[model samples]
Structures are given as C-alpha cells and as structure tokens.
Target chain A: GENVGLHLPTLSVQEGDNSIINCAYSNSASDYFIWYKQESGKGPQFIIDIRSNMDKRQGQRVTVLLNKTVKHLSLQIAATQPGDSAVYFCAEKSGAQKLVFGQGTRLTINP
Target chain B: EAGVTQFPSHSVIEKGQTVTLRCDPISGHDNLYWYRRVMGKEIKFLLHFVKESKQDESGMPNNRFLAERTGGTYSTLKVQPAELEDSGVYFCASSRSGQLGQPQHFGDGTRLSIL
Candidate 1:
C-alpha cells in the first residue's frame, strides 16, 4: 500500500538551533500535505500545510518544503525551543478528506 | 471558539466488553472524521461524515466498529465485542468544510485499553 514515512524516529537538537524533519511519501496523486505536532497526552495539533501546486510554505517559525519530483516533504523549524519538544508527523491527503500519516519523529530539545 | 471535544479521556475494558466513544465537533462544522493510532503505528483514518451522511468509510477496520453522526452535530463510535487489538487512542476531528486546504481541528483523544 502507498504510505508516508519519516526518515528518523527520534531527533535531539540544542535549544536555539534549527531543526529539520524529513518525510517521504509514495503516492504521487496526493495534492495536499500537512505537518502536525503532538504533545504528551494530547492529540495531533495542526502545525502547517502546503499544497502540491506550491513547493514552499511558511508559518510563524516553521517552513514546509515540498518536492513533488522526489515525493519528499520537509518541515524546518527556526530556533528550536523547549516547547517544541514533541512528536512531529507529516500527513498527505489521499482522498477528499482522508489523510495518510507518517510514523512520526520524536523531537527532543536540549536545554 | 471551542475546538473538538471528546468524552471519557480514557477507557479500560475487557476483551469482550463494549465501548462507545463520543465526540462533539466545533459548532457549525459539518465535516467530522474519526481516526485511531494503535501502539507504535501511525494514525489511521477510520471514517468520515459529511453532515450526518457517511461520505467515506473505507478505512473502517471491520463491521464491529460502527460510527454515527446524528443531526450532523456530534458523532459516536461504538465497538462491540471488542478484541485485544482494539486498544488504542481514538481521535475525532472536525473541519468547517471539506475543502482541499481546510485544516481539521483535533480533540485530545480517548485512550482505550483492552485487557
């Protein structure tokens, strides 16, 4: 089955440094991609999203880069903070309202 | 505005016991979705409802799992004769529309532990 997968299961970064998470998807028909953050004891929260038509999209301190040619997506966070510690997942819209999610990457911040 | 809200943050039941999970989506949001994460696996979609109508249910694991959205306001997922594999975190999400770019707001989720 076509799926979305992450490059790393866990990542540790120093505070104030930048962090990057990578995701690879197999379904080329997916037209929309999103990034979500999940803290302990909570559900996945929306972080940012990018449309297939565009290759890059930016939010407050986050940027989502989409490479349609390679079917790869990356989320870059500027100036990692303590609150940034969580599991980050990349999801692609498979159908009208169905989202296919990756295994997720646990991001830990070093203070 | 209040985001998606789910009832009974956690549930513990035996293998044969039945469990019903409820979700109250944001007001006026007609699109509702159900998803679950089992152990180490990624979140998987279960079903989707559009204004009390099931738009898609291809992700439903089996007939043992039933979902209903009455009046297109709140929805419930019922698992009867649950099995050990039914244990996981069930999350409910809602969006104002089914548009391509609309982001779905999620609830905290209900953790079900099947013994």
Candidate 2:
C-alpha cells in the first residue's frame, strides 16, 4: 500500500540551532507536498510546500527539499526557537483533492 | 476573514448513540475536507467536498459515517451507532479552490468521545 512516513518519531534541538525532519513517501505519482506545524490541541497549520517538479522551496526561516529519485522529503528550520516546538507533518497530494500525511515528527526546542 | 469553524468543540456520546459534527468553512471557499486523528495516530483524510457534491470519500472508515454538504456553505458529519473506536478529533478544512496543491485552512477540530 502507498503511504507517507517519517524518519524519526521525535527530534530534539537546542535553541538557535537548525532542525531537519525527514519523510519518505511510497507513491511516486504524488506531485505536490506540504509541511504543517501543529501545536498541542490545535489543527495543523500550513508551513511550506513543494511541487515534485522542483527540488527545493524556501520560506521565512523554513525550507523544504524534495528528492524524487528516493521519494524523500525534508523540512529544515533555521534558528529553532521555543515556539517552534510542535509536531511537524509532511503531506502529499494524493489523487485529486486528498492529502496523505506522514506519521509526523515531534520537534522539541530547548532553551 | 474567519478560518474554518467547527461546532461543539467536544462531543461525548455513549456507544450506539448518534453524533453530528458541524463545520463552517471559510466564506466563498468551494473546497472543504474532513479529516480525523485517532488516539496516538497521525491525522488521516476522511473525505472531501467540492461545493455540494462529494469529490472523494475513499477514506471514510465505514458506512456508519455519513457526510453531507448541502448548499455548499456548511457541512455535517453524522456517526450513527458510534463505537468506542470512533473516539477521535475531527477536523474540517477549506481551500479557495479544489485545484491541486492549494493550501487548506483548518479548524480547531471537534473532539468526539464514544464511551
């Protein structure tokens, strides 16, 4: 079965350090990918997105790198802050309108 | 502009009871989606609606769950004879268009507890 999965369940980082969360997707037909941040008791918030046609995309303090050959996706956060602590999910646009999400990586930033 | 809004932020129901979750998507957003996160599990897509029609419902767990989006403004998800395993947080999201790669704005979600 096709699914999206995370490389790690949790990631701990010190404040001002960089954080990278990795994901692996099995479906090669997926063309669009997105990263979302969800705090405890809240819905997932959109962070950044990348299309399979491109290898990389950048946002404020965040970057998403996609590798089609290995079907790997990564989200990089620069200068991790306390507020950046949350569960980060990587989702792929499956089929027409549905998005399949990865297991997610709990990002913990220590001050 | 208001984001997606869900009613009854939390719902508690006994097994075999019925519960309906409501979602009011962002105004003029023609695309709406329903998703769920079970305990200790990642969020999963349930279904999607493009206006008043169902776009895709492949993710719906079973026939016990019924979703309707009349008038294409607000949508409702009804679970009949809910089971203990039905306990989870239901989230609603909306996007300006149903086009591929469009970002979906989400609501806080309705927590449903079936005891």
Candidate 3:
C-alpha cells in the first residue's frame, strides 16, 4: 500500500519564480522528515530536513515546513532556477535509518 | 570526500539468472544501507549494515537475496535465480555517523531489468 503521496505529480514554474511542492503522509508515527533533489541520471541529493518537533527549517535557497498536526510536509524554493529542475521527494524516517519516500514530484523550471 | 558509488549503472537479464550489485560508501562512513523500488512501488528498505554486521534486513523480499558488507568498507547484494519481480532500481546509501535515522548519501541506483 502506498501511504505516502504528493498532491501533484508534477509542477512547473517560471525561472526566477518561487515553487512550492506539497506531500501528505499516512503514518502518524513517523518522527523525522527530509527533502531531496534528484537530477537526471543521478542519485538523490539531500536538501533539507525537519523533525517532528520543529514546524519549519531553512537551508540555503530551500525551506522545509512540517505540519505534524495534519501529517503534511512542503518544500519551497526561492527564485527557482533551471538547475533546480528535478524530481523532489519527501521522506519520513520511522525508527532507524529507514526512509519511506513519497511518490515524488517532478519540478520543471521554464526559462 | 567522495560520496557513495554503485557499479553497473544498469543491467538487463532474463529471469532465473543471477545478478550482483555493489556499493562503495564514503571514506569514514560506518553505516551502509540498501533499498529498492519495484515497478509502481515506493522505495522499500532492503537491509542495513553497521561495520560489517547486518543490523536490519527486514525488507528483503525473499531468501534469494543475499547482502554482505565485509570489512564495512563496501557492500554487495546478490540475487540468485532472480525473478521478474526483481526488476527495479536498487539504491545504496551510507552515512558518516552510524546512528539510526541519520542523513544518508546515496549512489546513482542500478536499474535491473529482468526479462
């Protein structure tokens, strides 16, 4: 059963514009969340992460907001660039190093 | 330090054949992990290794799958008589801190296609 899924499978934004991607998780027991960026033909690169305790965390040009009340997570990119075009994933960490990733959201930057 | 690296970016073979996937983690990383994403499925955990020892292997699909992390420097996953269901992307990751739930660096996955 796919418990983790995004509201949108794809999102497109203009260059220099902001982009937001949302994700919904089914498990209430998940205590940690992380955001990753995956480019074509490459492994996922860690972006930012937020714990259940913190509602928001900021890193570089990206920010991760967590809403534990609704089990929702979102990633926001400022002034999205062409290099930012890739599949974005939200993952939940249960107990150990195991991460359950969402379906994934492909973000495209239109120049 | 160089990040994790996996060999044979892609593979294709008929069913009932054996295949092996390898992963080389970061220089000082002590935690190594294996995960797979089957067709139309999420990335599922395959196993975890901490310093040449298996910590968790609860996600391995069946007995045909064997994973080893000798010397804790690198890891290998072997699939014997692999079935068609084994066709998918296998990803390996590692972390510097051998703690549970740490941020993991990944290797470009190996996409295995079984006919």
Candidate 4:
C-alpha cells in the first residue's frame, strides 16, 4: 500500500499558552493557503488565509505563516483558550480548481 | 449579509436508506460548492454550481450522489442507498466567483450517520 498523503501532526497546548500547528503541502503550484477551525460536531470555520506571494498573515488572535521555501505552512494561536480547541485544517487552492485540504491537526488545549 | 446555511444539522439513518442535505448560500453569491469530510479524512471537494448549473462535479464520489441547484438559489444533495462509509459531515460553501483567491464561506455542515 502506498502511503504518505496530506496528513498533519497533532498539536497540544495548555490554556493561556501559545500553540503552533504545522502543515506540509504537496503541490508547490498552490497559490493560496487557508486555515480553518472545526469544533466538535461543527463545520470548518474560516480563520485566516495567505497567498503564495506572502510569508505571513494575521487575524484577531491567530496568525498564518507560509514558508514557500519548504512548502510548509503554520498557524500560530496566541494565548490559546479552551474555546479555540478544535481540529485545525490547512487547505490549498490553485486558480479556480477545487480546494485541497490536509488531514487536519487536532489542537487540544489543556485547561 | 447572512452566512451560508444548511438544513438538518444531523441525520442518522440505516444503511441503504436515502438522505438529502440542503444548503442556502449567502444571497447574491453566484458560486456554490459542496465538500465532504469522511471519518478520519481530509475534507474533499464534491462539486461546484454556478447559478443553476453544475460547473464542476469532478470530485463527486459516485453516481449515487445527486446534486441540484434549482432556479440558481438553494441547492440539494441526495444520497441514495447510503452506505456505512457515507457517514460523515457534508459542508456547503459559496464564493463571489471562481477566482484564484476568492474566499468561500462555508455552512456549519450536516452530520450524516449511516447505521
């Protein structure tokens, strides 16, 4: 069986601390990268997005860093709260093609 | 503007039963799309509809999944004879257009459990 897909590594952080979730994308041609958050029994909510032209972008309490050099992207959450605990996914889109997503990283915040 | 909306937050049905999920995108948005996330898997694109026509449905898993957007408004996805592997969350989203960077607003999703 051929393995190695778009799965991401899980990240765990304590409440009030910072958390960083990383993802490695497959397609270098992907022009835009987005970060989404999904809580239990809920859908993925838009967090922030950055293009291949930029290295970083930020929102209220979260920031997305794109390292095109290594095809690596990451989301940094500041002062992580339990409410922010959820499954975080990184999605890549090229042109008008369908958006492709990583396997998702479980962000567990210990309270 | 109102966000994308989906019907029946959750649905549980026996295998081989049929189920339908509905979605209403933000008003005036011309591009609507459907995505699905299976258990322990990444979210996969199902199809795209521009107005009342299906622009792209390359990701549709099989023929059992039927999608329609009548009158270029709300849309529906019908899954016939649902299988155990069909249990998962289905999401609907809409974008201003199919540009490279346009963001797609998503619905909360419908959780389907095939027993």
lDDT of 3 by residue, B1-115 (tens): 8989998899999999999999999889998999987877766789999889999999999999999988889899999999999988899999887444468888989989899
Docking class of 4: acceptable
For residues B57-114, could you state the per-residue lDDT of candidate 4 as single tens digits? 9999999999999999999999998999998889999988887667888998998889
True interface contacts reproduced by each model, as a fraction? 0.69, 0.63, 0.48, 0.54
Model 2 residue B98 CA deviation in Å: 1.9
TM-score per candidate: 0.95, 0.94, 0.93, 0.91
Local accuracy of candidate 3 as per-residue lDDT tens digits, A3-111:
1232438899999999999999878988888888887667789898888888998988898999988899999999999999988888898777778888788899999
lDDT of 1 by residue, B19-95 (tens): 99999999999999999988767899999999999999999999899999988899999999899999889999999
Candidate numbers sorted by lDDT from highest down? 1, 2, 4, 3
Best by lDDT: 1
DockQ of each: 0.50, 0.46, 0.45, 0.42
Q: What is the TM-score of chain A in candidate 2?
A: 0.91
TM for candidate 3 is: 0.93
TM-score of chain A of each: 0.91, 0.91, 0.90, 0.89
Q: i-RMS, every candidate? A: 4.8, 5.1, 4.4, 5.0
Worst 10 residues of 1 chain A by lDDT: A1-10
Query: How does chain A of candidate 4 score by TM-score against the true chain A?
Result: 0.89
Residue A26, candidate 2: C-alpha displacement in angstroms: 1.6
DockQ score for model 1? 0.50
Q: Clashing pairs in model 4? A: none
